[model samples]
Target chain A: MQAQLIALDWGTSSLRAYKLGPAGAVLEQRSLACGIMHLPIEPRDIAGIYCTNGFELAFDTACGDWLDAQPGLPVIACGMVGSAQGWSEAAYRNTPVDVASLGQALHCVRSLRGVDVHIVPGVIEQVGLPNVMRGEETQVVGVLQGLGTQVLIGLPGSHSKWVEVIEGRITHFDTFMTGELFAVLSKHSILGRTQQPCDQFQAEAFDRGVQVALSKDGQRGVLSTLFSARTLGLTAELSPDQQPDYLSGLLIGHELAGLPDHARHKPIILVGAAPLCARYQRALALCGFAHVSLAQEATERGLWQLAVAAGLTQPVTEA
Target chain B: MQAQLIALDWGTSSLRAYKLGPAGAVLEQRSLACGIMHLPIEPRDIAGIYCTNGFELAFDTACGDWLDAQPGLPVIACGMVGSAQGWSEAAYRNTPVDVASLGQALHCVRSLRGVDVHIVPGVIEQVGLPNVMRGEETQVVGVLQGLGTQVLIGLPGSHSKWVEVIEGRITHFDTFMTGELFAVLSKHSILGRTQQPCDQFQAEAFDRGVQVALSKDGQRGVLSTLFSARTLGLTAELSPDQQPDYLSGLLIGHELAGLPDHARHKPIILVGAAPLCARYQRALALCGFAHVSLAQEATERGLWQLAVAAGLTQPVTEA
Candidate 1:
């Protein structure tokens, strides 16, 4: 099958390119280290033009070969690659946007290779606390096809995002520093001092942490409960090996606890790395969340849908 | 006035020696950089004995001159100096302890000069979640006199402690890693990337942070609210200089929000650096906490009381 679109998930640390056949089928894929933050800096000739820009260098390295194979392939990219510091700034679109609205708003930046790359605009909510996200909005669009009218989509990563979708439109969302906080605390704070790395999963310790986050003590909030991570070790209640997972569960539990009460009633969809999504699944179950499911290949499918909606590509026809 | 006792506030990063005269009045004082974590390493002759021990070197450096000037003066020390990692291990005393009990239970470590340094044992609470404190216990003891039967004392610092005292006995207490979290987040996390140092305090931003913590949105918990430190900046709601204070107020607000409901009705006392205490004072006021006040010279005063109670030093007669 001939490729219909080239979808790129270009985030802060990694870039993943997908060659989607008709109907956004995965035909070929490539992973590169050159996200916007880590783009190649060496100058090189591209399309008979001398180029030194990191963005152009990264762009060629990521999909230049695929583009050469089929020069007319429509290119669409998402994530921090379109931030203010990215290849080209894609101004954030306000909330209540879906594939149709955001697809129509793709910011195009022509590459030195003479290929126009359509960058998806991120979503922002300003109702109360200003919440923003670039990449997760695509995943939300990807997974909305078969979900209920009201759904909560959780994209867990360095910065976990919980997006609320009503019908097919993105309404509101929240960003949690849970993953980053856990990383920073485990790597730099006193909590890391006693944490022993382990090969086996400390399920009991993790469950205990989730329970603590839901217990009366957790009502005091994470700032107060965070000390338990260290004190529990001092009291010989948590072994050094169990401390890391315990801290993980505690943070994930707190993140889940922050979800709106209505979220418990909505069908929840999670999209992220398998291990992290599994952790969230466990924590959500512990938190009494009943309707939870995981979604796969969200970014490519969302990018495909947006590409089609924007007339960059056509939907697959019946065989 | 002649020196009656030498009191040392020995903590993790710094040590302070105070000479108290009649009625526990300040006679002389010295500050040393050598805390347990940063003790001096050079070999030196002390009291006719060659010593290479870091603890002995730090001990001599802290107040060897004061001891030489008044060889018979009694000495008492509090804080991390009593931990297992300190110069000598002082077993933690369980909670509901008063000055009399802790005073009588001083753990004595004999120095190279043949002088015994009395170390105050820290307090540990075993109820529900375990909580521990070393130096702050002495401060709690110092500020207990003449207060109401039941009062809450807050020691704001790297690890802020909130103690619930009843009739001069520490009944229950909690520790919040607020100050340390703020430091690590500001220095190491993405939150610090946009923060600009300003000589002037951003009171408005700080107050807004406190309000956000107390607001309905804050009910979601701090792990969720922490993202606002960046989002508020992205939206131009907070300037670079205001970001730091805003984060400070936010964390402090969440810490205060964790306080039990009864804390609002009980008298509250804060002890620490005047500037930090003032920040907490302002936040506490914003949180609707009415009966809040500050205490001064808590560590030194508490050390004096404990020394007198332990019979290490005689009580001064009124002049």
Candidate 2:
């Protein structure tokens, strides 16, 4: 029942910690607003010393007490916490890497609590446009278990990533700015003027948006189709309440359309927030992606697999 | 020379007034920061009457002196002044409308000074996605005078429009939120965080962006290429100063790529701010669009033609 590894999913705005037991099972979990960008700033005492560093303060607040009861728990962290601006820089590892290869490249940062936190290095694809990812790599590593050779993993978020794996190695990937683009367009652009937020999901409008993205007009690309979000409202085709979901569907559709050609024949796996993944699931269905499924607890599982791969923790045999 | 017509080009952010002599020649002109959205709020006396209406105040300020000198001059206005939110709603005229046709449908709003201002109605294309234009319609009408039978007119700005005119009739048109997207992403998104303003145009970066949009990767759409604006910077391939122009070029390139198939074979005319038009010209060349040209004084010229078409002014014989 004792914890074997402490896994931290630290991102730009939020931090999630998991206490994994024998056989890589999640024993306890905690979430904190202590992501690198919003790290704790208040001076706090840690290991008989006043810790002034934001990373140290955040690290202590996130799981300092979890380590108190069991001091020997090996720590593993992923995401922006290993970037250039993280507690300690973990240089990015090139792509065509797997959990085993990435596990060998984990960066180490010693905290004031006398614990060495192993940080997972983000992946960088040097080919083409040079795509980079921080936390999604770990999630991809977690989801690769027992998957076929032709696998397309989608991690949807502010910057949605479509990663293609060939026999457990991430051979190629693409990043789409759909979510962030939608956010900025809705909050700061002229499109925001007419959008009226509604509680009920406007499935019709959302479907219409997805359809439009697949239609010939959508062939013009999103920059052109985006105007339709407002024009449809002006023409009263889409009510105010339907605008947001319509936009969401439209952006997701465009992102789906932008996926590399190899994704079409592959078995797709989606990992992200449930709501966002649900949106992608709907869009993927609309896209006629034959084989698709959603992943649960991807981050913790990926971190656990990575911990085992790194020899930092061993998976216990059950019964 | 005596002024024959008073022409006002009023839009969302600025107003320009012109006193036209015989032959629709500009005799005098003035510009004011009083577009419909930024109308004057200060109450003032107009023709001995204290008026508080924003439209009236803006109208008086833009050309009250010209009207005072010749109160009998016929007045014509165009742009957002005819929008639903303008002085008086000049209901949008359906597309396939020409200058003569639009002039016949001008809506009249009487000012505090007892002068009737004929406002040009904007054009709306209800086909497909329902495109609408307020100010750009006038510019299109202006640029259409001597153009060929087949014309593809591009007016690039906050919302760039491409109007397809066949034998002087606006048969169809499309709108791209390219300019507005560039502005919002540069000002409010994660991409903006790494951008640094530069006085000089990053021509190389701009050209690279355009190329990327036309490349095989660009076939995936801008929602994907947009990530390059940041990844390129992260990889040290694009500097802070180059990011903005690169994004601008990328958006413009995608917009050009979205233009209907018919545009390639026709003569293309661009009407907008000079610098923006120049950027489009560069992008057009990069896009292999050979038949591209720039226009000047499109608004005032279009307003003058419309006024003459309405029998509000006569072309004086040159002596």
Candidate 3:
């Protein structure tokens, strides 16, 4: 039987873990609604456990029982589990780390039940730019392993990250809180309640916001752009759906405004959710990034690769 | 006993009305906790009579009989009262309007019986720089009279306003949603609830934030600056109280970064709550602004001044 390797991607709103075979294929995938952000700080409180559909307990019980059933198996973890409030802050290893070097002993420790556990070290790009990354380090490695060339990877989400890979090593990176800005703007700014959830195209307002973002004078600061959405709506000019897109344009525009000097002509690969990934692809294309493409579920795939590097899974060719 | 004109400044959370004598003196002042935002859409639902302890019930009963006494008023209104939910919106007279020429005639028709109502026109400066103002226009005029200035003025609040006054004439103005950014950054950003409220000077984390804001690089989009506050607190060895202030500094710094050039050299006047006002005052001084000072309840006094201008009160000699 193939040995078991556990790979997890713990996000703010969801938890996803995959049990991998020795050949690195997913034997079974499990997820729970319990994210670290929702957990009560008081360890005694089981509120997250109760609200979650038996996933956390089941994960622990099943993994523990499986380990008992078969001794000498090791499980490795990554993602928000390594954040300060997570399992523990996975001390960052400064970048330019080789995939072979990532073999350095994973954050190995014993669980409450005395089960041997290994947590991956989140990468910190402190040399050129002061940025921290957890699961994406594995994703960059995976992309590098698959691509076999220097690449510009755009990891989009609450905090969209961009990393530079040269010769299978992550040279440098920066974290832009793009996705986070969209969340606050949509949920708390004056335009918060007005952002209707939809995938429909808000071509018009987005164009306007993009124009503003592209302007030399307008891109100075984006906080002012939010008020325009309210005023435009009040004046019967902007539609409800357009509000989110307009805000998206403003944020993406600001992000683009600060793009690294080398990024203008670089090959852009997006790694995140579908709509957002698509939006970044389009925004970059508008900014003359013609080689833009999507990197699907790179975070999860990244964690799995880290598992392999941690000696939890056997290396297999990317499908 | 010349007929006194009562000036009301009713908004989302507070209701304040002023009793103006034939000679513009604050003969009496009354305030209530109920604001229009707290009331439901139905007019009848807002008709009940309620008064605070200090208010005379008999006098309230008479006023109640006059205008239903719940949310009672001397009657001229400004602020949110012009929104779709507040009193119906009064159309604006576009820019360069004389404080005397705001020509913001109230929607007298929206009042209940015996409530002779006039809701001021919310100013709209749509042409060049594009800005709209509702309640602040009246206050600007009042402060102008109070200070006897035909100079540039600033009003810092949820929306920081910059009004251009040339010889008692408001040439043009613009609005910046600065306070809203602070609220969103503190409550909704990834740093959500991480930076809790603390006394202004008592916290060192706040000073760190201010330093970050003053930093050349930290002056970029505030979203990026916000994450640093948590990072600094966790890694840089800062006290808890200072975290919130650092957040305030980043937000205020972002506001100052985008402030108009013309207003920077002018005598800057502030009109708002103390702490927020004080924060803006601090921001102005730090930004190399030469002259900055605060004005007392300028909006209320501005409304009172409007009453005098409308022949509702006789002008008093300069005190």
Candidate 4:
């Protein structure tokens, strides 16, 4: 089947692309190590080297480069690639937004090669403190379509997001730096300097961390709780290899604990990479959340929905 | 007066030496950039280079070296110099320990040059989660002698310690990796990547962070709230340079919020370097803490008490 549309999910350290059929189904997919921050070439020329041999390119370059290899097609892109630092800035749409509204808010740009490019706007909440998301909004849109309204969605990644979809609109959301914290702490902190080989997750240690995080009644926050990861190792309560999982549990557990009280009773739609999803699923179960379900290909699905809503692609018929 | 004893406060990055008279007054002091981790010489011969002209010495060699230049006198050391990776291991004393008890627990060793050396023991809390402190015990001991019983003391640093001193004994304490977290997040995390020239503290941004941290009711935790540092920048609510102080205030505010209820009602003794103590003092005041006082020369004063307690130096006669 000839490609009808192209979808891209470009983030800090990765670029994922999907070629879709006329029915909005993914026909072929490609992933690259190139993200916005690590782009070897300048941002202006990124579209030129999209499919080139070496430097990984972002959406505009990838789309322009693909069109250079073949012909033009409608392209939908999301993630950090749409930020002020990306190919073009797609200003964030304020929250309490419906999926259809997000479709109208897509930032459209004509590539130098004349390809139709639409960058989905991220969501921002400015009520108490400012919170923003770029690529995750698309995933949340996908979740909203599948799970209907009044559902809680947990998208776990570098910056995990917990969204509240009330009656088909994103009323509230929060971002947790869980994954990022885990990564930095593992590599740079004193707790990470110990010569422990952490190759895989240890369930026992992770559970202990979850328990400790839950036990905190706001009196002792994560700052104090994190030290226990080191102390547990020093006291022989946790092994070296278990430290990573323990740290992960501590962060994930804290994220789960921070969820609004109403979100806990309902089944949360888990999205993102399979491994992270599984970890969140386990953590949610441990936190008394029993009906958690996974949503695969959320980014692609959301991009397709946005493409259709924006009238860039035809809607898929229900199978 | 000629030096009657020598006291060393050796930690991870620097070494400080003080020469004391019979009355325990510091007659002279020297500081070197050498520490346990960066020793140019082997661990065993550190004593011999104490009074040497170069950084090519560890604690033991420096001591031996100092003795070589003059007659034998008792030497005392505290901090990471006695860590497992230091000159010799001074086992951590269990909590509920008296100020004099730490002196008795000091690890005594003789250098190859036959000079007597005493290393003060750190305190360990093994009740719920294991926590160990190497250098802060000396400061806690000093605070006990100066503040009397039933006082709450905060020794802020890389690993900030909040200790409960009752009747000249260190009963319980908590360690917050506030400074370490600030350093790591500023240098390595995405929240730190924003081009904020954070040389000096920005009071407005710092106050905002403290307010946000205090507003968290254990629901969102620090893991989630930390991202506000980035979002506040992205939304133009905070400038780039304000980020560092904002982050500092957030961590310090969370640390203050986590203090035990009893500790909040009393005058908290703030101990550490001037700038960090000032930051903590401001944060404390923002958190509704009044009557905050500073303790200067805490490490040095603490070492003197331990020295006299261990019979390494003559007891000071109160004027």
TM-score of chain A of each: 0.98, 0.98, 0.83, 0.91
lDDT of 1 by residue, A1-319 (tens): 7888999999998899999998899999999999888989899999999999998988888888888999999999999998988999999999877645788999999998889999999988898989999989899889989777888899998889998888788888888999899989999999999999999989999999999999999999999989999999999999999999999999898888899988999899999999999999999999999999999999999999999989999997557
lDDT of 2: 0.89
Of 2 and 3, the candidate ahead on TM-score is 2
Cα RMSD over interface residues, candidate 1: 0.6
Question: Considering TM-score, where higher is better, how would the candidates rank from best to worst?
Answer: 1, 2, 4, 3
Q: Which consecutive 10 residues in model 3 chain A have the weakest lDDT in total?
A: A42-51
Model 1, C-alpha of B58: deviation from truth (Å): 0.5
Range of the 10 consecutive residues with the lowest summed lDDT in candidate 1 chain B = B310-319
Error of 4 at B159 (Å): 0.8
Which of the two candidates, 1 or 3, achieves a greater lDDT against the reference? 1
Q: How many backbone clashes does candidate 3 have?
A: 10
What stretches of model 1 exceed 4 Å from their correct place?
A317-319, B317-319
DockQ values for all predictions?
A: 0.89, 0.87, 0.34, 0.71
Across residues B1-319, which tens digit of lDDT does each residue of candidate 4 receive? Answer: 6666888888888888887776778877878777877775433334344444223345444454456655567788888878887778898889888877888888976655566668898889988777889888888766666564588889898888998888877788898989899988898999878947766669998888888999943238888899999998998888888988898888998888889878877768988889989888898998888778988777777888888887777785444
**Regions of candidate 2 where Cα sits further than 4 Å from its true position:** A317-319, B317-319
Q: Each prediction's Cα lDDT score?
A: 0.92, 0.89, 0.65, 0.80
lDDT of 4 at B298: 78
Q: Whole-model lDDT for model 1 versus the true structure?
A: 0.92
Between prediction 3 and prediction 4, which has the larger TM-score? 4
State the displacement of the C-alpha of residue B240, model 1, in Å, after optimal TM-score superposition: 0.7
